[model samples]
Target: MSLAELIDQPEFGHHESPRHQTRRVLLLGNDDRVLLAVARGLGRNGISVDVAWCDPDSPALKSQYVHAFHSVVPYSPHDDQWLDGLHRLVKQYDYDLVIPCNDYAVVPLQLEREKLDPDTHWYLINDDAFQVAFDKAKTSRVASELGINVPRECEITDADVRSGFSNREFSLPDRRSLRFPVYVKPRSSITASDVTNKRSAQRVDSPDALAEYLIHEFPHDGVLIQESFSGVGIGVEILAHQGKVLMQIQHQRLRETIDGGSTYRETIAELPELTEATRKLVQHLNYTGVGMFEFRYNRETGDWVFLEINARFWGSLPLAIAAKANFPFALYELLVKGQTNFHTNHTIGVRCRNLINDLRAFRHQKAEEFDLENLLFGKDYLDFYAPDDWRPQLATLVHFARSVLGKFTRRIGFSV
Candidate 1:
């Protein structure tokens, strides 16, 4: 059956018939690339997409895919006030699904589930699951419990801060036998925010440097200190419904924006290790939602060590779509149609190029190692620049133009 025919069945839950249900998704965080990709994907499936954002003049507001736009003051999703606004919005229009694009929104949205209509679906990993997913320390504990291979780590909380240069400090941990080049990062943080709640990490070669960094930088709200693993990065994206994994795909990172972050990037090819770990994690969590599991292929053991799971839809979704596992459509089926015949094994050979980071990766590669063909025409990763639709694409173009003009006008002493 055609995808539309499958989704239109009575068992899928839309009594309004296919045409009426086609355009009924409400998307939060309108500016997020994942939301845009999700919206575009849903729109393609005959779903009408509406957007709400703190920034009304968001470039997304102009998208033809978006049916209506709501202006909201930027507020942390963690706050109760944001939930109140969401409740009011829900009362006015029954949004079939609520998708949070950033990490900061994941926890609060999950916790405040009671405020939403019972019939309205949200695809976040459960609250307890999210606590583990968002916090590195908690994730390490859970992985150990689940027998998943991961790094050994400890969390340094605000209480860990101690006074003076005393040898009897309560905050210090015995690091005599721990491996050198240990990695440190925040145990918890909100979206696009400061890296350190109060403390930062400097890779320490000696015990004194570790002690000094902990004493100085991590007088902390939250931070994680763990053994560093060397490996090729791989990501597995999946969709779960009723706690069952419905679709899965794995992709290797050919480039990254940060040393260990997914700010922007592209894919190389599907990695077997990443695909397996993604399945293992979703099974362990008994999770129901759109999730991505990241793994670092440890060179030391020649195995992929579980890193952390994004308990919500992720940033590189377009790449996943281009690579042949369209998670957004799978999610729409679950939320709108409640369909379960959701299995696929499509793969797109993706390569993200022209992005600032991908450009850097290209420059880093030696001439003989570089393949110039994929750079010109996308071999794998989806570039926001390439669009199947003209309206949202034009909207993005105008938005980018205004951004450049705003910067130029500021340089010329004009107030924006």
Candidate 2:
């Protein structure tokens, strides 16, 4: 039978002998891919999954593993109505746990943990530590103090803000200090409520480009201007309870978007430097739940520079699951079962691709380092095309087409 047909089969959630208890989990995030992966991961392990998202047509809604779906206020820094809605859902459904899958959702929940139902368990870092992690500048300073390598950064000045697209050429305190091709990004990873065009990071080749971006693109926003590191992006995903790490998995980005987001990545054996750095950071924060520490591996120096910590499930979570890390299930066990037999070891060299976004990368011609031949013929795990749950894959295609059409219509002065 086809995967779609099998989604409705009676045996979908009827495991003969369940490994984990049947606890209802409410997952929060708009990223359907991450939601779908978590749903399947926990659902198959005998946990009931419910999803709350802003988009009604999200692919996670189509997953058979999701017992219920609810539309809540979209992720925003200032909005707290979603919390009220979530409280009602928790009271109504008596969900055993609440999991926020993105930083946008994670931060708000962390800030208002007291407002949430005390009976409902949520694994998250404390607000004080999260504050340090959320801000790039603060994170870099803390990591550096901890004896971890971090990209050199300069403080933004009031003069820089006042310059604001002026004719006067702007210059840094130490003009010769920074190498060319530095990155200019928001000081804090969280997007401001008033900001319309949100960006992760921008690479600026010249000082002129850097000044122009800060003045024009994000005039009112606080930004970090840092010396860009030349290296490959590596993510070390860890699941911790209190101050102790339960599991850690490493993945190397093979290809990413033009700006800087992983599209293709593969599981790799843990490196001592990367592993040690991650442990130090996580322990320092006394973080609970799942977090991924991103690093830049300088090929020439063999040094690992700490980037930032994502205090929630990351985009490439499915890749970790595909390599047998099973973070979602591990999280469920930790939060609900009170203990877990968490395993850190995972199969190395197992590649995982987000096919839809990979296509976007291919369209932009950005992933030059990726071998087209390997993408075509090599054995790999696909994020969306799961054998037991194929409908989300189809949903992804439809969503992509609709998005492209929407962009086209807007360009041509039409509306869809």
lDDT tens readout by residue for model 2, 43-132: 888888877753566766677787777767654556667677777777776667888877656766776677777776775778877888
lDDT of each: 0.61, 0.76
Segments in model 1 whose C-alpha atoms lie over 4 Å from true places: 1-22, 57-62, 76-81, 163-176, 191-213, 262-276, 298-301, 353-357, 360-372, 378-381, 390-416
The digit string of per-residue lDDT tens for model 1 on 1-416 reads 85333322221112232334344776776335666677667776777776665255443444445566665444454456755676666656666777766554555566566765676566566766676787777877777676778765556666654544345222225453556566667666553243112232345565566667777766345677676777767777778765577877666665554345443344545566566556666776777788888778755677767877777777677676665566777877777678877768675555543243354554554334445565555453433544553343344455556677998988889643
RMSD of each: 7.9, 4.7
Residue-level error in angstroms, candidate 2, position 59: 1.7
TM-score of 1: 0.77
TM-score of each: 0.77, 0.85
Cα lDDT for residue 142, candidate 2? 84
